[model samples]
Structures are given as structure tokens and as C-alpha cells.
Target: MHAWESIQASVDYIEEHLNEDLQIETLANVASLSPFYFQRLFNRLVNKTVFDYIKMRKLSKTSEILKSGNSRIVDIAMEYGFSSHSNFTRAFKETFGLTPEQYRTEPVVLNHFVKPDLILNYVMVNENVPLVTDGMVLEIFRRRLEQPRVFAGIEGEIPIEQLMGGETTGVAAGAKLWENFHKIKPRIPNLLPDGNELGALYLGNAKEGNCIYMAGAEIIPGTTAPGYQTFEMPACEYLVCGFEAENISQLYGDAVFKADKFMNRWLKQHQIRTAAFGVEMYYPPSQDAAYLEHWSIPEVDS
Candidate 1:
């Protein structure tokens, strides 16, 4: 089976047996991979280690049970494998930003634990028309990048919660920075012609909520543009995912989010090494649709 197919099988198994103890060795065997390789691959693709994913899922289910107002908190916690009521409360608060009592009172919607669907290794895009996956034209490529590109734009270190929600102040800050960059675009020297409005992502730890993203463009060598910060990227092989959308403005951020998720899974399944960084490329509009690209570093073999 393909890497994605195998990995997906493991995911299905986990979902089916959420309450049971899941061993890494068992999951790795399901994926037909070694314990070490499978563990690393699962972490990279899912953005959470296997244990974390299982724990989060348990908490997520518990939250729902809490909303029902039926089961006692202690019993619910024990059912989900938490040893004590205090342990469950601590984890629940950390994951959902609310204590069990607070959550039970308000029952606010937490971030959805989206089950990833299979991301096709290849996709086709046609200009002007809405994208249809008929295997028409595949616009993907793998390029070896030997040098890093310098970027100048707005930078924001946002809490992951705010970043993912799109309605948070963190996202607003990024929007403001992008807007400021545009106002001074003409004055920025050495800007690349037809440059991609890249949203470069720097994620340190999957479990941590802190993430840094840059909204910027490639600049010429040794060029200094005032009022903008510079980020120097290291060179590596890249997998370029291409698509054409009707509204490029709305697509830019959405594309980056989806691409990052897909790439995280893709990179591990293929045993491709990549830095935790990704670039979002926004190109000029075409007659048919706005063209966009997501660039991901494919780790070089040692």
C-alpha cells in the first residue's frame, strides 16, 4: 500500500478503538512500518504525536459527555483513561481553555478535531473553470532549491488558537501587516517581479500553541527596505503544489492552511525530510482564475 493509505489505516484503527490502550508498536505494525519510522511519520503527518492525538480525542469525547449533564466528571475521566478527576480537569482546561465546570456551564464550541481525509498525491487544475478532480492536468512539481530566499514583510508571533480561528486578534494583526506592506509596496526596493505573497510558517512544536507566520515577498540580494523585517530561508528541495481559484484573495490563507496540513502528512509518508516551514505563493490573476502555489521543503537525503 502507498504511505498515505497505510497511515490512514492506522488512523482508522485509532478512531475505532479510542477507549482502548493503543500501542505504538501495534499502530506501526498496522502501517507496515517499523516502530521508529512509524512514530516519526505519524507525528509529522498528524501534527501531534500518537499519544497526544489519542489523548486529545479522549478529551474531545469527554467534553461532549460533560455537555450531556449525565455522567459524573470522575467517571467520565476514568472512562477516558485519566487516572483522577484533577488530572482530567487539568488536561481539559489546557486543551479547551476552560475548566470542566466552566465548559459544562457554557458548553462553548472548542476547536474541531478535524479528521483528515485522504489528500491526493496528485491533483489537476484548469484555468477559468472551477477546479474538478478529473485527472485533467496535474500542475505539481518537485524542485531542488540550493539557495535560500530573503523576504521582507510583516511578521507576527501568534498563539495557535487565534491563528487557526481566523477571527482572533492575531489574524487581524497579520492582516494589518499585509495591508501596511501593500501601502509601501512601491517604495520597497529590490522586490521580485511577479513575486508570491508568501505566508511563511514557522512552527516549533506541534503541541505548543505558539506559531510565527510572515506575510512577505522575495527581495533582491543585499536590498534593504525600511520598515520591513527580513527573514532568510535555508535552501532545500521543494514540492510545489499548484492550483487555480476564482478568488485569490480568499484563497491565499486558506490554501496555506490546507497545504501545510497536507504537506505535513505528505512529507512523512514519503520519508521526505522538511523543515517545519512552508511558503504560500500568490501569483497574479489569470484570465480564468487566480493562480496560487504552496512551496514545501523536501528534506535532502543525508
Candidate 2:
């Protein structure tokens, strides 16, 4: 947490001078760090370089102003640090995959964070199906991911039972615990690689609407997250499994089943095992009820 104070200060400085032509050196000075180290650490902790993060945040908020239909794009762009209308338009297109006018035509890009904003209910809901003989049902083509640098995104390394709550109590607690994401100091977009829409999956006991919300994104080691929270996922092999269906819930059940199967196999081979907790990173919720992103539970040999 040494850099926590400095990072917050930098953010404050940026907000106050959002319209100014602040350079990287100026921002590094805000945090009292040398330019080179500040750039590296800031990217590692927050998942975006200082300039990019500031620009994106400004643009996201600017989009809000544009939606008001009161101010002109040129004025908004200048106010938010864009040098010209073309510059703002180009950046906006890259970030949102649409031009400003096109954006206004579509639905608002959801700005939900995976924090404590999720409301909860406590009621029992059962959606379990029998496990297969092998326990793992789907086959995943494993892909090597660049180890992402995540700041203190998670307090504790979560396990299978932790990632997916156990019974009724587990569901209730998980939902409430993950709701704090929506209450961000300054939420930034970490869009899903597939859809580029930034958000999280909210799972809960539907009978009572108790939900567990997992927010955050996969970033290269250079990128940074808000709150001085940073993470560097150690390099490891991952097994990815996906399920296609009309319902999102079944998709998870199948993916989890695969993970269970893999875990059992690993345990049999090693007698005991240690590894990073692996969780599903789902596609945009808008894709369909059938989308899922199931990651192999990250594990390290003991």
C-alpha cells in the first residue's frame, strides 16, 4: 500500500486538470515518483498507462455529457483534453468500437463495477445436476495467457468453493461481498476482450435474488487498476472450457463440472496440490443467455 496515497493524489490531480495539457511528467510529479518508475508501476497496478487512463475516463464521462444533448462535441472534447474533434472521435471509436454519433444510437454502455452495489436476498435455490463419471464434461482447448498484472484486486486468493458459493449461506454471503465493486473511487472501463463491453457476471440465488458479482478485467502486466490495487498473475497453463446453450445458468454448470473433473484428475496425480484459484470469465451478458468464460483453476505444484 505504499503507492496508495500517491496514486489517489494523481487521480485527484488529473480530475482537477482534466482539460489541461498535462504531460506524463506532470502526472508522475503528482504522485512523487520518477517518470520511468511511475509509468511502470502505474501500468502494473492500474492496468493502464497514466495518459490512456486519463483519456478514457474523460471520454467515458464525456459520453455522458454528450447524451445530455446540450453541449457540442468539440466543446466537450476540448474540455476533456482532446486537442481537436478528430482526436476525440478517433479515441472514442477505438475505445467503444463506435463513433460518438453511433454510440448515441445504441444503448448506454453499461458502467457497472463489481462492487457492493449489488442488492441481495436470502432464499434457497437449487440448480444442480448429476456429475458425469469423469466429473468433467466439456473439453477445453487450453491457451497460454500473458500473465496479467492486477493490483490488490482480491484480498485473498479464492478457491473453488469461494468463487462459487456452496449452499444457501454461501450464495447469500458471496453476493453481498462482491457488491462493493459498484462503489468505486473512480471506476474505469476494462472491457471484455471478446465484446469490449466492461462489466461483471452477477450470480445469485434467484429464488431470493442473492447474487455474487465478480468485476475486474484481464490486463497485461503493464496495465493498472484503480485503488492502488495491483496484481501480477504468475505464468501458468490454463484450460479453457465453454458451453453453448439457451440459458446462461446451464453454461456455468457445465463449465464448473469440467473444472471439478480437472481438479479431481490433478489431485489423483499429485496426492495433494496447490494452485491459483481459477474462475470463469464470461463473455458479455448481451451475447446471449448461453455465453460463458470458464477458466481453468490456476494451480501451482506444491
Candidate 3:
């Protein structure tokens, strides 16, 4: 197997055996590498030590379980191989800045560490032939818009660090903005019910390292909504990268992050110039539907 596949295999093994004792020797064996080499490769690829990755993944899983059901904290901790409740509490606080009990009492959106799908970084296939691996399907294609598309929604500025960090303390700024947009969407007129939601992220301040994020649905031209911001995408050909996940929950962190990375790499490899902003188009979940489409407008040479 290739290096990426080997690492991915070890990662999959870690996920399956998260509730059990995961030993370095065993994981290395899964990757068919020596423990020392495995450790180095894992750290280089994942940016985390093996031990840290496992601990963080366990804590992240514990957080999900804490929110989903009424289970004792100690039980959850023990299940994930924590030696005791105090140890678990200490680690949870250090990682998430909250005790398990506190998080369960008033659950705020915690940016849980998602399992990495490294294959997205390596695969680049034609649009006509999508790449499928481990329940993920990725497609890249070019699309043209005959006319400008307008969106009506609310806009918010998000820190570039938080947006790219892949983890957040509470409800993500973009998510909160989307919630607000949905709440006011009913009042917006001339919205196409069948249209997909669009989230556009543009550079807001280079020195400040912030980006402006807008969330809304497409609206008919000339449609006006009070107290709403309108964004327009000019008629142009776009390089679209899309992916589908078997588990809808993966759509948020794991899938979107990987897809964005893939799209950026693909553009760079092709020497493609794109507009300043990036667009994320969200579609309703269905067997036939792609949960998200990452759109980039190729710059037209003047």
C-alpha cells in the first residue's frame, strides 16, 4: 500500500479500537512500519503525536456521547480508556476549557477533533470519473453561469484563525450567521425555494486576518429584503469541487475542510486564477444530492 493509504489504514484502526487500548506497536503493525518510523510519519502527516491524537479523539468522542445521551461521566471516561474520572475531567478541561459535567449541562457547540481523511489530499480525478473511497465521493468540474446570481442574507466577519483552525470553542461564527439567516429567510420574498444556500467567504482584512462570511439563498433579481445584505456572483465559468459523505455529520468539519484543501491544490496545480472570494453551496441531504459544492470563479483574462 502507498504511504497515504498506510497512514489512513492506521487511522481507521484507531477509530475502530478507540474504546480499547491502542498501542503504538499495534498501530505501527497496522501501517506495516516500524514504531519509530510510524510515529514520525503520523506526526508529520497529522501534526499531532500518536498519543495526543488518540487522547484528543477520545475526548472528542466523549463530548459527543455526553451531548447525545444521559450517561454517567465516569462510565463514558472509562469506556474511552481514561483511568479515572478526575483524569478525564482534567484532560477535558485542558482540551475544551470545560468539565464534562458543565458541557453536558449547557451544551455549546464544541469544535470536536474530526478524524482526518488524508486521501482527499492525494486524489485528483476528472469530473466525468468521480473518485470513491471509504464512503466519500469527490468530483471536480467546471460550470458556467449565463447570468449573475444574487443572494439575500446576513453577513458576519470571522477570524481567519478560527475559520481555518478546524476547531471552535462554541457555535462557529459562520454557523451562527447561518442560523440567523434561516430565521429571517421566511420574511425574505422572491427566494427560490428550490435554490441552494450559498455561503461566500471573502478576505475582510489582511492585517487583521479576518474574512467576511455571508449566508443566504438565491433570490430573484430586483428582489429586496429589508435589513439584508445582497451578494452577486457575476456570470462566469467556475471551477467546482464537490464531495459527498455517507454520514451527514461529516459534512461539517471533515468533508468541507478536505474538499477546500483539495480544491485549492487542484487550482494551484492547474495554474488557475480565481476570484478573491470562495463560495460554498449547500444542498439538502439526499442519496442523490451532494451535500456541499465548493465553487471558485476562474479569473477571466482581460
Q: Indicate the TM-score of model 3.
A: 0.91
lDDT of 2 by residue, 213-276 (tens): 3444454345455553333445566655444445554444333443434444534453544343
RMSD of 1: 10.6
What ranking emerges by TM-score with the best candidate at the front? 3, 1, 2
Instruction: Return whichever of 1 and 2 wins on TM-score.
Output: 1
Model 3: per-residue Cα lDDT over 1-302, one tens digit each? 78888888999999988899999999999999999999999998877889999998888889889999999999999999999999999999988788999999988766666677787667676665687766777789889988888888888887676655353343466767777888999988789769878999998653477889999898877676667888888888888888888766777666776677777777887788998999998888887534788888888779
Tens digits of per-residue lDDT for model 1 on 24-129?
9999999999999888887776767889888877776787689886888898988888989999999887776779888787665454354443443333223222
Error of 1 at 209 (Å): 2.0
Q: Give stretches of model 1 more than 4 Å off.
A: 1-140, 162-173, 203-208
Ranking of all candidate structures by their lDDT, best first: 3, 1, 2
Q: Model 1, residue 85: displacement in angstroms? A: 38
Error of 1 at 245 (Å): 2.2
TM-score of each: 0.49, 0.38, 0.91
How accurate locally is residue 151 in candidate 3, as Cα lDDT from 0 to 100? 89
Runs in model 3 lying further than 4 Å from the true structure: 165-171, 205-207, 287-290
